[model samples]
Target chain A: MTSSIHPTVRLTSQQRLEGIWNKRTYTIVRLIGEGARGSIYLARIGNRYVALKISQDSSVISAEVNVLKEFKKVQGPPLGPLLLDVDDAYISHDLKLAFYVMEYIDGVPVSDWVKREGLSWLFPISFQLLKKLHKIHQLGYIYGDLKPDNILIDRKTKQARLVDVGGVTALGRAIREYTTWFDRGYWRLGDRRADVTYDLFAFAVCLLSLDPHVTIHNTKERDIYKVLNQAKSLKPLTPILKKALSGQYNNALELKSELGVINRKQLQPTKSNRKTATNPKIDFWPEALGLSSIILVHAGLFYFLFYRI
Target chain B: MHTGTIRQILLITDGCSNQGEDPIKVSSMIAQKGIAVNVIGVLDDDQTEEPVGLSEVNDIANSGNGISRIVYADVLSETVQTVTRQAMTQTIQGFVSKELSQIFGQETNEEDLPPETRGEVQKVVEDLGETVNLQVLILVDTSASMQHKMEAVKDAIDDFILSLQARTGDHYYSIYQFPARNQVVKELLPWTNDGKRVNKVFPKLAAGGITPTGAALKQTVKAFQNVPSSEEWRDDSDDIIDSSYGSSY
Candidate 1:
């Protein structure tokens, strides 16, 4: 409608782009990904590698740039791709394309990591992700589109890092972008407004999507309960997942605490017998109290047997 | 009443208007009434030549103070959702800019402001977008050339309504078809929050008529003005639907 603003033209390897404002030059290395908004290229400036996203719409580019900048203001483990530069580049004499450069994360999507390493990596990564999401929520923003495609398992830190800042909307705006499978509205659970509950719901849907036994087909007529029932390895998380899907949690931190409980409950068998001895149904304080009492009784017996004798 | 509601008329057409008044003029008038008019040109894949009516789509949207998109039938659903949300954000941003100018005595876009203040303004815009009530009037061109595209149009509207269901604010949607049986426009579905209600109306749509887009849009201006309040709809929704159905056909 606006005369096709250079998104249709694919940049070849070694194509150079210079920022109209910053005047920095970047050499296109290869295309990393492409979505409805634009194409992301792995580009080189000097020896540094950065991911550059080029789009026809200036507003889309600006929105994402602002989110990335906002992400920097929040103190936490890096929640998303680091914003490096924002500018417009002329591809031809007449055509101007909006682009932004960010730190290129070399990691596989969390779903792929799950497929490769097994389901054990699921809960830990999920916990870590929720921690990141909580920090984001504290800043009054929603990771509007929280799906496996946008989350990457950082190869170096082994932490789950969000990649696409495009959907990082300030809390309360309508969700900017979303995949239907991860959207609660599509499942008839909630609206698409950017809120903590919105992200939590999508996070639960994302977890459901990663399970090997669960298949999320593109259908508007899906029963979320039925889909949750189909999960095998993620079955233990079903309760927490339901809580999120039903918009039960107040914030990501609350959901994180609950997910922590489930994660610990799931890992109890692999832990020491003392931890396994603790009842899974009980609260954390009760578990701590039970362990302390066990320690205290053992200490009293050892002192009486050794020192009193 | 505290939240300023954003009203929109989203028109989906596949061809040029061949009947009645000029759609561009009608859209300009609609924009003057503070209602944004967005247009989507649904192009079939087989059409290799520059699709007809693309310029009208752009002109209508531009003069109507909204955005226009030309998308193929396959991706119509995604485009519809994006265009609607983007237009809502733009409308809110326009208001935010006006407020900024009044406060600072300097005209500034959000992007031009420093990061700290910009972030604060953006937050306000986001909150307003979520809290504001929304009413979308969907106008579809059911000309003979658009018969094959009717399915895609229906799916797009269905998805659009589904997307709206996720918002915090109240949403009401109504559907209009141009060139109905012996009329310029027909009310296919009255303003309702239920997305499933479209199912009953979509199947009955026979896409064969002259494209009287201008007349249809003119009728929509009246529809918007006479929209029954939520209370009124709750009282006699069935009657409204029955009467509209009887009159249109």
Candidate 2:
């Protein structure tokens, strides 16, 4: 369905959209972000806030709507922004625009959350994000563009919600969209297929980016590997990062389990007393027995020599 | 930020640099940061004044340590695949030679090895090629004079991507068309593996406006500068690297 609106048309605040399914009118409060394919807006329906995504390109909007509808059908824990309603509006005599409404996630991006709330939150946040991804993977879909911007973290709820569902691709399909930094293809580690391991690799990079000490940039492959390997904050995650970077993981759940283990190990207190208790004792009987055995062996050797002489 | 792997900027234009920073200087600076800049000059028939851009293209490619090819529009598809693959092969060979020198006591070039050894090395190189991430930022000139060449460019890009996919499954491509209707250079497609995605933007790529080759080059460099951070991580359960290392030992 081509929108009557020109592909370059931009929506302004206070613009109203009536849902085709529910017939609920949503007022666009403000523009959230604009990308090449579409624009996301903060919309208000009565007193409740919802995210209104409007795009001139029908295919882009259709892909997002299809994925959202599929997720809604599965009815599991919310993996991303919930799809509220979708409709097409006539902007002009010759132009029509497609729009969709989703649950508005009021939170900061993962990167900002880390900077504000401290890196300690990354462990729990990462675990939550992984669980979400596992759910999506179980449903046979992959969050193709798994990046800090696409992920929003609720500080109080401690839930990381995936935004921009346009990039989500079905398992085994070529990933439709991706940021070069998070893409294994960009790193030359693997193909751009929507598999569980793809998300796991991006998740590893996400954790690596959380470290203030580690600055991620586009460089030579060797340099990137070196940076990942030498990242001080990622030292504990080095083995995991290397595997993920090399496309070793089966799914996000496996990564989550390992991350949990690492986090728990780091959080546990060191046992100094136990270490001291395991020290060798100064028992004289064993020492004497050892010495006596050595003397007896020497005596046997002497006797053999004397007999030979 | 350092994008791990060799970053390649492939600028395919049919006109000269008319605005902003000199393409050669921009490419030189990019080269200094270990990025390779390659240029493909698409020439049209009946315009034989040796488009001034050809000299700048050669200089830019030379400065960036990449190959420069000037081909007529009709042969662009085949030549594009060849030029890009050649550049990629050169990069892989350079990396392999460096790695070999580091691992062994002697410095050896890929060509110097015997046939059997070379085959093994080639296999390793191909394997490495799959893992070594590559970003190809294609800058296409979409000026009015170049209108007839867009389809050919699209076909060439399609073929190029297919050949690349066969050689190494890991490759991300982004296309930026210059003298864009609204912007100096519009992103026809973001970094993606799916070539069909470009079809959406190709039909709408009207050839008009001035060819701001220099400004587009400057903008292309800026786009490369904005490398986003990766948020994904790997699972720790399987220590593939460790197991491989142990087996080797």
Candidate 3:
């Protein structure tokens, strides 16, 4: 177990750890990533690939483990990593570390996926993430951190799964951690208390981030407002975004309903076809008539000058 | 990523400028480009005397529209963090207060804000701290006079880094030591988040040579110019200045 003070332990491929609680032997394949909390590793249990999160912060790990334990009991569509096992391992004679293994999610980050698949998937991905948040909110939990990096989308399934559950805050509790760009609290539009609306706000930011046209360089209040106002891609969902940003939406369900409307509107061919068809007609007829009148006037003037003279 | 309004340069020194162009003049030029330049003067603890460059530090900070502080070397580790935090808070507050004035009209004061609004303001400030990719270009003086205070300055810097990380968790630092053996300013470390890596350079940074504060400031400004801003997706009609904005740091 690595001491909580110095949590970063370099692990090599094929290293093994015997789960103290489950007595399951897992072989590490490679390090997937590292964060302030600790490191994540891709490990194998027999033929299955699983994700192992090892951290020296016992309290943080305990909070996540607790949340996952509670979250597992809630019956719904799969929302995040499925907890498989939790245990402690001794790395040295005196050092022991807490770790947990969950179902491995094989997918690229949502932002990368959006870049590959295009903006058409933005609504669906956001809708799915919202649905997940709605479910979590119903279970009395809030995903405190909902950023592009925390969400993974399986390209084949078009399924979005959230990672880094450590920041999950109990409903009505102060949020534990969050990325400032996605956080409404950072925008000076809302507080940090965990609720469905907080997640909705972050979801709105997540959408904005995935939309290549919407660029956010600073989380300053005025700057965020400026970016949101100027984002052409977000024009269709401006009202919803405005409401979400201002903390008007009461719940994820309300936000999801609004996004569903946007989804339907985006998919409707008639509305867009009508727009394209009417624009040229409105623009061309006046120009054509004006040109004809001008030409007639010129011809008449020439005829009068020649015949009258 | 440099799509924001806040840009800052932190200069830490122990002595006056004895070579190169005028420091205050250079600071004013940086200010004209909308970059705030702050100065921290480290004083000798053993001697019962004022730091030689205190007045210049104040002048430079004033010209740059920033803050200046002077502290004994022994107390630098404790005060440096506070000074930097104060500078950042003040810089952000300037923007936030202006915004508040716009929203509530020019007559409004921060104290008169509603409790909920005040809380929101606090969160906004914290958010800016976290989201703003702050690039701190630290200009350290390595003149022979700074030798006695070098150890204390190093410790102070380490504390400053930890405090910054703890407070905002979003900052990138670059170190430029003035009056190198051969060059006017030496790049001790490139931009990085690893404090330990930055600490490694301290032992190797021997304090000697004339203090070319002006040349060092100019070089630091040039370093900032070399960093490319994040590529933005903009329509031709968009007229915002593309030079500085976003989290390019």
Candidate 4:
């Protein structure tokens, strides 16, 4: 695995640009997103552009790097960012920092994109994105911190890139949360992301959140309530990710082989809105109305004849 | 009225700031030059009635960085800054007492636990030993400060569950950790006998939720409902006592 760049409490300005400045590791030309956790920078290596993430804690950095490494080792599924390079090394006695490079498509965060170009444009890409997350689980590392901020969207291509593995745990400490199976040693379904199925659930939540009609801004009461409810209800991955999502389906390769990266007929919403049947029973309606109208006409004819006579 | 020169009177409360006494002003005035007084603004739910008005004081109390919010209880709605600060002083005294006990472990026959409390704890342990229904409902505080604390609790609970299970030699005991949030709003997983499964669920319990002790208790009681209760178990004070007001964690 490529060494990832890590953050530290101590580091000279020059040393901070070790692999970042020079062509040896990366060529960080511009800064990207910044949040409470860390910062992301857009950099270049050879002709390809990449995203670089710099975090504070070493464990966070390790968790992220390990996830990417694990994903790559398992030849991860095709949903999120592909790990390219890393800067996993200590700069000094006091400073423990690390970071890594992702396939940085020149894109903005999906939420920002939603704010910019209304919700109508969210589909296929959003669907593809959720489908990709399922692939991530298949690859076997929980996107421990699954949120809009972590997942970046390529504005031009409308593709989603999954990033940030910091909060993830392969074999980690007790975060003591109560779940159905509370015994020790046995992997609690809540604690670890053993399979891709759970990630699919999260992906579903992500998709529903991105829905144009819905307003899922933060982790507020409404947001959590709606999203978690919607997530638990999602039926299956779109036909694209269906093969891989199925029970008999084994290996991430089968998905790519079955369906290419992009669908030719993109899922864009049109004005001819398909009225999804919400258990509408229209069979008796037309006949009942027509019969009523016929009876009324006949009665009117009979009344007219009787009045004339 | 020489109640011994008060070094620093800390007011750790949820509603003190709301009660016309500005926590920031008070804490700042005390912390500036001479005295080392502190004032804390607890961010508790208003439904509890105790945390009202105090949420507003967070900015001011944390302003000078002199006064810190020491301990804020979940689920109660009363402004408890006064009570909390008083408890804090008591806590300090308790700590000093503990230190003294440690130093004079052999010499001092210290009275730490009240006779009644000791008897209750003894009864709980003894009751636990009797039937081996070792139900360890681990209510972990998943707030930011309690991350390390959670780690400790997980370890302790793990060890405790292991020891208890070893004694009983059955899949009986369980654990349920609650992130500091009220159930009226949202709750994490409820209680279960899945201590073995905690290893996976632990990381999912990240910090950053409001403390809701009532909800936690309600959830805990719900967890207990799954465990088979007996007349022997019902006769104990734990069974007789109501849990709604008791959950301070």
RMSD of each: 10.0, 24.5, 23.8, 22.4
Best by DockQ: 1
TM for every model, in the order presented, reads 0.72, 0.52, 0.50, 0.39
Residue B99 CA displacement from its true place in model 3, Å:
50
Q: What is the DockQ (computed on Cα atoms) for candidate 4? A: 0.02
The C-alpha stretches of model 3 lying farther than 4 A from their native spots are A1-6, A218-222, A267-309, B1-249
lDDT of 2 by residue, A1-309 (tens): 111112334767787776543567888888887754578889899999988888754435555777787778665558877888766665555565667788888888888876665555666677778888888888899998888988888655657788888668778665656665776765557766678888888887777776665667634352447668546655677887788777788888788788777774442112422332222222222334567889999999999999999
* lDDT by candidate, in order shown: 0.76, 0.67, 0.68, 0.40
C-alpha lDDT (0 to 100) for residue A281 of candidate 3: 28
Candidate 4 per-residue lDDT over residues A1-309, each given as its tens digit = 011111222333224334422224555666666643356777666777777777653223434555565666544344456777655434454443456678776668876765555443344345555565555555444454455666776665556666555434222221111111111112211222233433433443455555443454443342233333433212222443333222234433444344333433333432322232122132223334567889999999999999999
Residue-by-residue lDDT tens digits, candidate 1, B98-156: 66676778787655564345556665666666767788999999888889888888877
Candidate 2 per-residue lDDT over residues B155-208, each given as its tens digit = 667656654564334567788888877788888887777766766767877887
DockQ of the candidate models in sequence: 0.19, 0.02, 0.01, 0.02
Candidate 1 has a TM-score of 0.72
User: If both were scored by TM-score, which would come out higher, candidate 1 or candidate 2?
Assistant: 1
In candidate 1, which residue ranges exceed 4 Å CA deviation? A1-12, A95-98, A218-220, A253-309, B1-7, B13-36, B41-66, B70-77, B89-135, B142-172, B189-215, B218-249
Question: In candidate 2, how many Å is residue A205 off?
Answer: 1.3
Candidate that beats the other on DockQ, 1 or 3, i.e. the better one: 1
- Model 3 CAPRI rating: incorrect
